[model samples]
Target: MPSSPARPLHLAGTSPVHALPPEVKIVAAFVAVFAIVATPREAIWAFAAYLAILVVVWRIAGISARRLAPRMLIELPFVVLAVLLPFAEGGERVTVWGLSLSVPGLLAAWNILVKGTLGVLVSLTLAATTPVRALPGGLSRLHLPGIVVTVITLMLRYVDLLVAELDRMRIARIARGDDPRALHQIGAAARGVGGVFLRSYERGERVHLAMLSRGFTGTVPLATAPARPRDWTLALLPAGGAVAVAVAAWWV
Candidate 1:
């Protein structure tokens, strides 16, 4: 079989996770994140449960940890900042490796790290399984403002075109011996970006005209129907688990 084109780092196969209606997954993801966010900073077990939920989803989606490892590194900066919170936090201090660290700060850091990591992992899982095109439709079905969905739709559709145009421009500049690494090349790069924007704007206008010629309506038609019960069940499972974990964390 012919291989599929390389998708964006955040997008992949049409597994069950991907096949679930976009709106369902979106809502489920939001609920899971909300549960994580609402859990107390000291709720270590709750975060662990959240992580477990993510791991299960990962398995269901057939997305290996190895495949996700590189992308997960994107959270490193936030994690680093969270790690520093312990040292900067106020109140009682604890000695660790010969340095005084605030107890509250340590807990705060732990909270941020665990919550943030799980959130990122959840988001990554969703994006990896879901097609980019389905996202706007899901948002619209969930009653997101029409204008907001339209903007997101246009951005996603044209972003790659813009990037490709920019790449071509850079290549052309390189052909002319313009050294992109040189400090003086900064202005050239800026100009190249500006050129790409102008070209993209023109392309957008042409596309709009074409659409209007074809009886383009304000709304994009969905390729799929309303979500089924199975979609809801699949989506709700993780969300329900997250909620249960949150409750247990608070009460237990």
Candidate 2:
């Protein structure tokens, strides 16, 4: 495999974490997420331990907190929900600065914000270290349903194509004096969206027909990459750390 496939969000790097196979990273990422989800909200220190674990993994991967922080803004909607929960949820109200808030709701909000942010960061770490090309293989290795794999494979392949088609349509509309920015052109905007959807559907039908004619099997075949020594061992380290965190949360 190339040092880095030129896929969106795949940061090219020479870190040890980058060298690990995609399957390992995927499993490790999921393990860390599971650990976070299993942890009790009261065990705040346990969440801190999980953050430290991620920081260590990030360092090993040559990723920085700065790089991951901005991307985590995608969790803003969840953050908003978290903020609202303290006010909207009902239980054991406490007054703060003349404002009534529920104690349990505050805890629930904190749980959502902290755990959700950590989950986003973990996923971003995996994406930074692994390219999209490797994802299908990794998922297949984990014995994901063939239908699931097939759907993801197709999406990965054609998302860019669909985007390009959309861009071309936008440019053509502009050339024809269709003001996309004009408040008066809402109908045009809707038609453009409808056209893109119809075109995409037609393209998918054609592709499916072509595949069937070409002896396309229902499932995408998994690549048989030979095993590399110590890959799983290295990969499992983070997962083990996550498990340890969970154990500490429960016992301590």
Candidate 3:
């Protein structure tokens, strides 16, 4: 059997999570994140339950901690802010480890760190299982606005081209004895960014014209197979569990 080509952020797998329809996975991820965000920050146990729910999904998806832990670092900026909040925020003070901290600040920090981490994990899970090309079809199935879907689809398709263009510019700068990494070269780097933007806009216009010539409508045709009723139920199980945990957190 021929191997499938690898795409960025997508891990090819034979797990049931990989087999799920894109639309179902999208909806499931959204619901899970919503549940996580809606849960009270003071309910510390609820965050643990949310993490447990994600772990179960990760297990079924064949994703290991090794694969996800590094990606979780993307939330480091939020973590930094969270770390400072207790010291910087003013409210009722409490002592821990010889440092006096604001009670409300501690809660606020916990809120940011926990919610941000859970949200990022949910998104990573979705991206790992779903192909980049399948995202448009999923959004369309969800009945998102046509223009919004169209914009996202085009952005995904062309973002790589813009990145490549930027790389070429960087190489050119290096060849011309200009160090893009130097502090003084910031202006040059900014100018390069502006140039890439102009090039992208022009390319978009050309592509739009080409698409129009081919009788392209506002919405792209979805070639994705429609998901079954069972698919929806199976995909939604985690989200349902999350909702239950959140409600119980509120009630207790």
Q: Write candidate 2's Cα lDDT for 1-252 as tens digits.
A: 222222345677998899888888888889889989999899999888888988898888788787777678789999999989889999799998999998998999999998998899888889889877788888888888877887787778787777777789889989998888998988887887898889878888898889889998876666657336598889888889988989888898
Task: List RMSD in Å for every model shown.
Answer: 3.1, 3.2, 2.8
**TM-score, ranked from best to worst:** 3, 1, 2
Question: What TM-score, over all chains together, does every model reach?
Answer: 0.86, 0.86, 0.93
What is the Cα-based lDDT of residue 5 in candidate 2? 28
Which residue pairs clash in candidate 1?
86-105
Candidate 3 overall lDDT versus native: 0.89
**Deviation in angstroms for 64 in model 1?**
0.6
Candidate 3 per-residue lDDT, tens place, 173-222, comes to: 99999987799999999999998898889988998899899998888689
User: Which one is best on TM-score?
Assistant: 3
lDDT of 1 by residue, 131-173 (tens): 7888888887888887677768888887776767787888999
Worst 10 residues of 1 by lDDT: 1-10
Better of 1 and 3 by TM-score: 3
Instruction: Identify the superior model by TM-score, candidate 2 or candidate 3.
Output: 3
Clashes of 2: 0
lDDT of 2: 0.83
The prediction achieving the highest lDDT against the true structure is 3
How many residue pairs clash (N, CA or C atoms closer than 3 angstroms) in each of the candidate models, in the order given? 1, 0, 0
